[model samples]
Target: MTRFYWRKYRSLGVVTTLAILYLIVRAKNYEHKAFVFLANVHPSEPWEFVADFSNMKYLNPTIIDFNLLDESGDYVHWKYSLEYSEKLSHWPHSYNTAVAHFNIKASPKKDSYFIHSTHKTCLLFGLYCLNSVSEFKFSHGNSSKGASCEEHIQYQCPTVLSSFCRREVVYQRKAIMNNLFKKFDGRKF
Candidate 1:
């Protein structure tokens, strides 16, 4: 009788584990909002910076390459690779590299310009449960010389995991912005 019960429980355990794995691998529903950072630059400067694919390699230290695939009017398609760097080598997902496709839109009106970017990884099970969209709104600054740019990065994932990882995601976004600001050489509009 004990042997019989043991086998039943073992089968149940295996099924349960498989179900959890499936949820983790296929969940894909999360939204995270980070603290917005405003940059001192011209509204056009920020939108133009991201529109040019080559600028990513300079703005972001971890990004080694960004290839432009297509551009039609305000829409742009590009693929980028994040390489292993000393700063990311120790993180859980850092060892796993990602090549992702970005769909970007550049919208400029009378007073402001917005850059919207949505991305998905090339691999099916890319990073398990986390996906994100980043938007930057640049408006003419009150000062005649400089413009103000606001960044909002949102991360989406399964509910359980989103709660656990929200803070980390926010911190990561802030770090990215800080890095960009440090690398960017102020360009005159």
Candidate 2:
């Protein structure tokens, strides 16, 4: 009887271990959002502004440090540190800083520029990983000195934290758009 009981418990232990491993290694789906706005400046202006890594701090105040790791013909690898605060339902706000790495490829056309960037970061002691892709296209607008910009962002994170990530993505994108408009148009968005 002891042998039989030992074998049954061993099987149960193996099953439990497999289930936990599956939960830890499961793949997450990406969420996407696209934003379009007009800037009262030439297409090349905003394109240049975005392509330069040093100018990021001006666009996003949360970014405290920016560094270039590598640069090839049309591709650049960089990293930046950003500080943010989060508030839970009834808990006090928590402040944290995160460093993210980016790889960007830029292409210039006759009257437009396209940029593709990949971002990666690990959060919560590396238990949760966040990956995102951002595409920016700047083209000539209806007016001579106007430019139309489209930003598309896709992000992947654990399901439990997806809502929070979505909210942050929308808020940050809108804030960037507003800042861009103010910089180029000299008016509020």
Candidate 3:
């Protein structure tokens, strides 16, 4: 009689262990969001990565910033910001921000909205997510290697453009950087 009870208890313990493990794994899997890359380009060419705007890894906590400039070169005109954790079914469904301007002198009167978000990290990170979302509205369009990316890249204009105008300048800069950080292999963008 004791042996029988021992066998039954052992079996129950095994089953409970398995159940707990299954639940742990399931919960872990649920925390990860999978997404494919937006571009399949040669690593040597950054432009290739931006060719297809639709190809992006969805991400979480999308970064949004909108700023409007007035004629006096002042940021006093307007601003709006939106953040999203998911791209589809628009989790937190209704989010909209608006800024109004009453100034007349803003030359090229500019209002820009920028987003940096993702559902995943690494290649499926913020860069790919932003490009994908930007192109979502214009999928029925051209097939350029970096048209969409280039357009977005334009927005990321350097705080200094003249410094990047020449190839020799860039080469020299990178060579110097390599020499400076040659010991750091784990340093990634």
Error of 2 at 86 (Å): 12
lDDT of 3 by residue, 57-91 (tens): 21112223334332232332222222322221232
The lowest-lDDT stretch of 10 consecutive residues in candidate 2 is 83-92
Q: Which candidate leads in lDDT?
A: 2
lDDT of each: 0.52, 0.60, 0.26
> What is the TM-score of candidate 2?
0.67
lDDT of 1: 0.52
Question: lDDT (0-100) at residue 17 of candidate 1?
Answer: 100
Estimate the TM-score of every prediction.
0.62, 0.67, 0.21
Q: C-alpha displacement of 10 in model 1, angstroms?
A: 1.7
lDDT of 2: 0.60
User: Candidates sorted by lDDT, descending order?
Assistant: 2, 1, 3
The C-alpha stretches of model 2 lying farther than 4 A from their native spots are 1-27, 34-36, 74-109, 141-145, 186-189
lDDT of 2 by residue, 64-142 (tens): 5655555555333333333332232222243233444443434434476666776665555555556677887777655
lDDT per residue, candidate 1, 73-175, as tens digits?
A: 5333333333222123224454223433444444434466665666543223343424557776666665555556566766555555555456555555555
